[model samples]
Target: MSFDEMDVESIWMDGEFVEWDEAQIHVLTHGLHYGTGVFEGIRCYDTAKGPAIFRWDEHIERLYDSAKPYDMEIPYDKEELTEATLELIRREGLESCYIRPIAYYGYGMLGLNPSDCDEEVAIAAWPWGAYLGEDALENGVDVAISSWRKYASSQIPTNAKTTGTYINSVLASLEAESNGYVEAIVLNKEGNVAEGPGENLFIVRDGELYTPGLAESILDGITRQSVIEIAEDLGYTVHDDATISRGELYTADELFFTGTAAEVTPIRSVDDNQIGSGTKGPITDQIQTKFFEIVEEQPEEYEHWFMPVEQ
Candidate 1:
């Protein structure tokens, strides 16, 4: 569909809504040249109350956090951005959508350094569904252990979702897709299972949940954290530890990936070995069901995380 004709799509450029084709940046933009931008991928769910931004506050907090290491200062305040996001969703009359807020180094004198540019912000929204394969939720996905290794904290902070960092994910994802795998599992510099290219990794063993710890160059995924809390509430003990070997993956009774776009997806196999009888395991399915329920209504503890848009 044409940009304007596409229902429930809005592009917020600079400080206002613009035609999708009109949202352009100069070639000299520092972020374009040097990958010096930081952005957040957020989801808005249609609920009984109209539309609710899932974990809106947490996503904005991470957007700001992602900017700090690059010394980039965002121009807008939290409440302002939040309001803009809500308005954009409402204007589009969207039921469910994907929202993006980006802070980047704008047009500037060209070269390696970025000091000559100003930081610019843009927000956009579009109707979005599952980010992965159609059967990814039910049949689960097959993943290859990528030859590409994840970046070390000493080289670049993995904690921040910087544009520069995603090159690693891009290459790994390309490699995985080319090889007929749905995603790639990148290992840390030390050969530990770091995470899926775009999501955090979780495995279930004997009915308990296990995921890579924060120190292992993970993104500290909001969905991962939410799943942990939900798992505990459901009486499942969770483990956060370094997943050092492929042996753990092959032996695990269940596996999954978690992120903003990923939501909760079970991993049916790794490389060629089947994960627990080659089907979505019971605990993984349980957590996935609970997650869907939780996002549909704000649990008392997570109430502050959501922002409601009027119908």
Candidate 2:
């Protein structure tokens, strides 16, 4: 849904709540021009207790980690940001929503160096359903191998979710849409399966789970980590350092992408080749089932994964 149509009316910015329409930034914002900023995409699910954020602490930590490579420090501590986000959600009266916390170089000097510019932070929440589509979660999505290659670690800090790096993702995802596909799968410099435009890649073969490691220039996604832990706990062996080749996509038994936004979506076809059964595989179903059970159901054993919001 569009932001205007959503129920959100207020945004937490710089320690104060501002009307959604009033949270404006200047045109000359340093991050806008230079793309030197860090951000996080978080999801708050409507649990029986209230709206609780999934893995809130881990996501907050990653936001700070993302800013480190650029030497940009978020002026506020984690507590301040977390409290602000929760309050913003409460104010919106949202049962479920996507939360975006961004720290950017705001209006000031236009030079390449952002040290002279102001560091501004804002937390905005809006109602969003599936990122790809609701059907993608159940029916799976058609993917294509993008001609664009993922940036190598030697070229830039791939681990950081910097605003500039997403330009590459934008290009790849656009390519997929133009080619009549739902999403794009990017390869690393060495032609290894890196990840999707904004999510991590995972393949299931022979009842095992495998994904590209940290060295593959793929972002260490929190959801990706959660799935790995979940799979292991469910008695499946996970291989973290699987340098999958381009041809592997065509032959993998089952494949899926994981992210805060994508969640656990199955890939039915790649480049027009059908995956196992041409649908979500058994292993993918099991993992996805367990993931939602924890996120949406809030079972006691996985309680630590959620940060309950008291209404």
lDDT, candidate 2, 1-311, per-residue tens:
77777767898988899998999999999999989889999999987657799999999999999999888879999989988988888877887888999999998899998888989999998987889998999989999999999999999889888898899999999999999999999999998999999999999888899999999999999999999999999999999888999898899999999999999999999999999999889999999999988888888888888997773
**RMSD in Å for model 1:** 1.8
Candidate 1 residues 83-200, lDDT tens each?
Answer: 7888888887887888889999899777766778889999988876787865898779999999999998888988898998899999999999999999999999988889999999
> Residue 15 in model 1: shift from native, Å?
1.6
- What's the true lDDT of residue 106 in model 1? 93
Model 2 worst lDDT run, 10 consecutive residues: 1-10
Please report, in order, the local distance difference test score of every candidate based on alpha carbons: 0.86, 0.92
Worst 10 residues of 1 by lDDT: 1-10
Question: TM-scores across all candidates?
Answer: 0.95, 0.98
